[model samples]
Target: MIAIDNVLISDEVVEEQFVCDLTKCKGGCCEDGDAGAPLLKQELDHLNNYYEVIKPYMTPQGIRENEKQGRYVYDRHFGWVTPTIEGQICTYAFRDAQNVIKCGIEQAYLDGKLPWKKPISCHMFPIKMSQSEVDPSMEYLNYEPREDLCSAACKLGKKLKVPAYVFLKDAIIRHYGEEFYATLDATAQHLKEQKG
Candidate 1:
């Protein structure tokens, strides 16, 4: 049996007890828009450098999109990311020789080259950062954990055992900042209360 903990969800937010069915979901977040996620200056530089190194391997359309954007910007809900190819599901995702869906930069990062990291928006999904109009504070809201609706390709064979909130808080702080995280936490708590 596959060990549930081996599934790679967000390190800071996903807990061991959580299980998702990614097959049915179609990576909704990735297909939702063209703007992608926002990026910090340092992150943008890292991504550009990664792009340069991987230029030879990227599709022509990918190169064109990168050249057009020039820099990454936070597109509200999502952060900075490469623009998607026409009719393609994800800009950074592609199938390898064995036909496995893979992320080019993620593979590079795993290989020890520091590719630009994924934006928080793409990194954290289902769980969202929502802000109250009456208050500047934001909240972290998790869409109910539904394994049945996840994409088959992305699903693990076993259950996960980690707490979602812990992973989320760590990620928020890492990508945004402590202040932003605090606000998000407050927002999440408020939303939870409202739901209850």
Candidate 2:
């Protein structure tokens, strides 16, 4: 494990390889999970604030689901999560020309309609962070290797020699800041040397 700033990072982040193969997975992560996309407090606020623009890009069913669930929903099992269409695909997701699920929130951000990118949690694929049991102010950054959706990604990343922390640099930086990510990079290099 690596400790930087207030985050405790798992070594698997440096050891594991992963790169999302969207073509094969077809954004399965957006649809396969039992629950909707998890949301932070600020994300819930942003969803409400940006609903006017975001609504146009969303599917009719997605819009209706959002209306029925009220932007976001709180569940005992999942805590606060983005509303889903009958608890299937995330309400913020839409199909592209290839019929692959895509995030409407991210599309809006890419189009310069919204200032923030999609949720940090969404951006940081395969990495889940939780408050540290030792210290609540700090966080535990762990690698969670999901099957089906991420297996191809893992193989692809291994073929290309990209580690999880390196593959997810931008998202890690976004969530934890540049200094934290720099430490992760350093940790990766050290691990590589140790293996050699």
Candidate 3:
């Protein structure tokens, strides 16, 4: 584990490579899960605040689900999460012309309708965040790529030589800070040198 401040990052974040192969995976992360994408407490407010703006980007089914289930839902196992469509695909996801599921919230953000992107949890996929079991105050960032859904991404990451941390640079910076990401990059370099 790599420790920087209160966060403990798993070594796999740097040791193992991963880049989302969306064309191959078809954005299964947005659909395969039993529950919808996880949401932070503040993100619920963002959804409520920007629902009108994001509505246009969402599919008819997603909008209907949102209307029926509210902006988000509480999961006993997962805390807060976006509601799912028929308990399958996320309510914030829409299928593109290619039939690939994509995040409507992020699409809205990219279009500048909202200042923030999707929920941090969704943004930092393959890297799950949880409170440390041993130390509640500390947060743990575990590199946990789903084998079933991420095989293509893993193969592509190996081919491209992109570490998971590097692949998630923007999201990491958004969640932590530029300085923290810099520290992680430097640490990854040091680890690489030691291995060499």
- lDDT (CA) per prediction: 0.49, 0.85, 0.92
For candidate 3, lDDT tens digit of each residue in 1-196?
9999999999999999999998999999988876888888889899999999999998899999888989999998888999998989998888888888889899999999899899998889899999867888999999988889999999999999999999999999999999999999999999999999
Best by TM-score: 3
Query: Which window of ten consecutive residues has the lowest lDDT sum in model 1?
Result: 1-10
lDDT of 2: 0.85
Best by lDDT: 3
| lDDT (Cα, 0-100) at 100 in candidate 1 | 46
TM-score of each: 0.53, 0.95, 0.97
Identify the superior model by TM-score, candidate 2 or candidate 3: 3
lDDT of 2 by residue, 1-196 (tens): 8888777888888899999889888888898776887788888899889989788879999998888888889977657888888768999999999988999988998899998788777888798877755777988889986776789999999999888888898898887789878877887788789889
- Output the TM-score of candidate 2: 0.95
**On residues 10-29, what C-alpha lDDT tens digit does candidate 1 reach at each position?**
32233223333444444454
